[model samples]
Target: MAGCGANVTLDPVTIPTPLIDPMPMSVAVRIPAEFEDYVHEDEVLGREKWRIDLGRSNAALFSQLFNFMFDEVTILGPDDDASTLAIDALIEPSIDAFEFSVPSQSRTESYAVWIRYRLKVYDSAGDMYANWPLSAYGKSEKFGLTGDEPLKRAAILAMRDAAALMIMNLDKSTAISALKDRPAIAVASAQPAADEPAPREKRSQLPKRREVALPPPGPAAGPAVLSMDPDSDATRERVPEGSSND
Candidate 1:
């Protein structure tokens, strides 16, 4: 008898920075009221430490994303509106109107963030903007990596993906079908005129599907008849009747 087995090992995961513009953006975060004191390490104790850590992680993610976008493009803010603007206004603390899930692995954790934001465009009163929800989850069995570096890198990567998705979602040009100038093609609703009958195509009515009875088989060609002379000298005959020709 022989035994065979495979040694399973997971390769350590190395998260890479997301590819996106490094421009900064004037974006603000609306953390959950429940997370207020959670950000304070002294105020946090025991298992609550995990909760505070999560809060800090989220805040950092938002800050980094905003900075990156700002570096690339100018982000408009509520202050841009003269009527509703405050020169030294502070971003209000609104409810975490968006729902998300954070699932962590030994080497990698999944991060998802959804923000119910209000984007004010030029001259137009803005509507509620729910940035596209994002999700990332994976694992790594890498060796010789620094502590927590892998996790941080993974978080950044996830955040980058999230940002790209949000931008794409907001871009109207990408959605040609929904563009204002291009409405859905119209389908005619009027009934066809009765005087103009539909064209009739000549169909060779599938040769009446009747059972074709074949004509009774003709008599087969009669076998050829052959004749021979028994008295011919050329033909030798056996002794006749009772007479023996000695």
Candidate 2:
């Protein structure tokens, strides 16, 4: 074979897949004196009732969802360290809440609490792209045998339920984002000062959001026309001008 100035073609090499990033979360609690509204007589005293700080207890449960991330949970006080996860909560006025239904009876009335929370999850760049607003009713019996224990228990469970709901959706966001391909270029690495604590501004503040109005209610049905009148008249008549009678 004669030697020629020929260039060899090189095929492109395939890159290995990127690793999945773990989901991150933070829980913020807002406890107020009004929490006592749901407590029963028995819960008013003793060590058990003391443990039932609904806001804090609920925050603890929510913290577990992101416990896998070390030193990530931030328990903020009226003035405390901001959390990496950046969840905020506000306590609203008490509303008509429902406690667990009686085991044997179907109907029961319980006190309900309304809590509004804002959760902001940021990407590696510390920019928040996912924001969630969570609000729900927490119910506890007004007066029960277990006393304050039931109230405390109810608050914890209710808070857990609300957090679980929010977490489910957030987990999906992470999974979906992970499956996407990474950016082609490398972003600049931002190292914190050796002695300074991690940044906590994004999580502490809420970004303005546009208002979304709910769909309007469906058209109202014509006043239900009675098939027959109370006097046994088959003819139908509009009742009292504003009402309908058949």
Candidate 3:
């Protein structure tokens, strides 16, 4: 509670045109529950800025970016409006890190933000069918000494960079494609992928059982009769006439 009192705010991020065609589906963007109690803490030169509210800014920018990139989608908020739409899936974005460096000898003033997210798709049984992780970061630097304005601009830049990264990676993401293709596999959700799925249980239909009769026990076995020993006293295994017996 003992620190500089000021407002660190953010404006909307400009959504970039997706590099690839956005998948056609209804997606709902949200902030994860784990962050419900989170509060942004900032410390600049021994003075602290307490309880910088970032929840609203983050949620809003993410919603705007996703809506611009994808087809039918909803930017969900805490106001309880998602119930009105038949969403095919939901996406949650979490701020993993938000750091800033004030003007100093070690380096110029800069800001960086990292974002991690999850896309959850459900099956017909209302069970989660697929879940995948997506993460990105944004950064900005200012050489001159500026008030909180530079910090605000840097944050916006970081969020914008994160959205751009999502757009670029969306085309190459196998998880997104899997959900688009079948969207009915009910398996446990997975961790962050390397643009590809990890080792998993392969799914395939069981081979059909066919009822076929065995070929009549194939010709009855015949007794072996030793041949080519009529004149010899010892009947050692006489190698068959044409077979080599090395």
Candidate 4:
């Protein structure tokens, strides 16, 4: 708090429509109150105080991103309840951590931002199906005397990085596409005649929701290389040679 301070506010971000077929699923996304008005404050080398406000940017980004990814999307506010809605699946997104580095601290001409995001998927019965954590990074070179512009650009780029990663890997990681039309199928098979008992095989027909093991609470590895194009050679190069056990 002793040195110069910078306050950076981000505008809502938009992602380019991905050139892929949308999943045939109707989904709901719940945006929490904290995700709508997120702010990060930190001191750099005990000299500079930085305050970054991401007001409604995360909510806006996810809203648009999901709309393009799924056939039908319903946006839910913090107070909204998903149990009343009929959908194939429900998704909740939250920020796990945010970090940045200034040129002075890194001894470089670039400003870097790192964002860790968590996505939780649930079936119609509200059972958690998948929980995935992704890290995105962005870097922007100093363009002017002040660091505000570069920092904002870096934050925006990090968001774009997240969008790209989700577009490319969401279904592969979470198997969300498999939930398409599953709710309707489940409802029809769950009910039985009042006089007759349900058959034992009917219960087995329902999709089983398994718990996803989360990594231990700690810092994850540094953000992977940033790429705006998920199909680009650079992005593909990052993929492991063999199939992932994940």
Q: Which candidate has the highest TM-score of all?
A: 4
1-246 in candidate 2: lDDT tens per residue? 332111211111111111223333333322223432232211111211222233323333333433322223333333332333334221111212222222122234442233444444444333333444544433445465354443343334344344444434444532223312231121112224578543433334322111111110011122321111111222211112211111
Residues 1-246 of candidate 4 have per-residue lDDT tens digits of 477759999887876656777888888887777887889988777778888997477778888888888888888776666676668988888898887877777777877677878887777767666667888766677866465988888778778778878887787777777777774222212234688653322211112122121110111213422335332312211222221111
Lowest lDDT sum, 10 consecutive residues, model 3, at: 212-221
TM-score of 2: 0.36
- Pick by lDDT: 3 or 4, better one: 4
**Clashing residue pairs in candidate 4, if any?**
none
Candidate 4 accuracy as TM-score:
0.74
TM-score of each: 0.30, 0.36, 0.58, 0.74
TM-score-based ranking, best first? 4, 3, 2, 1
Error of 3 at 170 (Å): 3.7
Q: Which ranges of candidate 2 are over 4 A from the true structure?
A: 1-52, 68-108, 142-146, 172-246
Over 87-121, each residue of candidate 3 has an lDDT whose tens digit, in order, gives 55555556554444444312545543434544544
lDDT of 1 by residue, 50-119 (tens): 1113333443343444344333212222223222321111122222232222232111242222223222
* Backbone clashes, each candidate: 13, 2, 0, 0
Clashing pairs in 3: none
Window of ten residues with lowest summed lDDT in model 4: 212-221
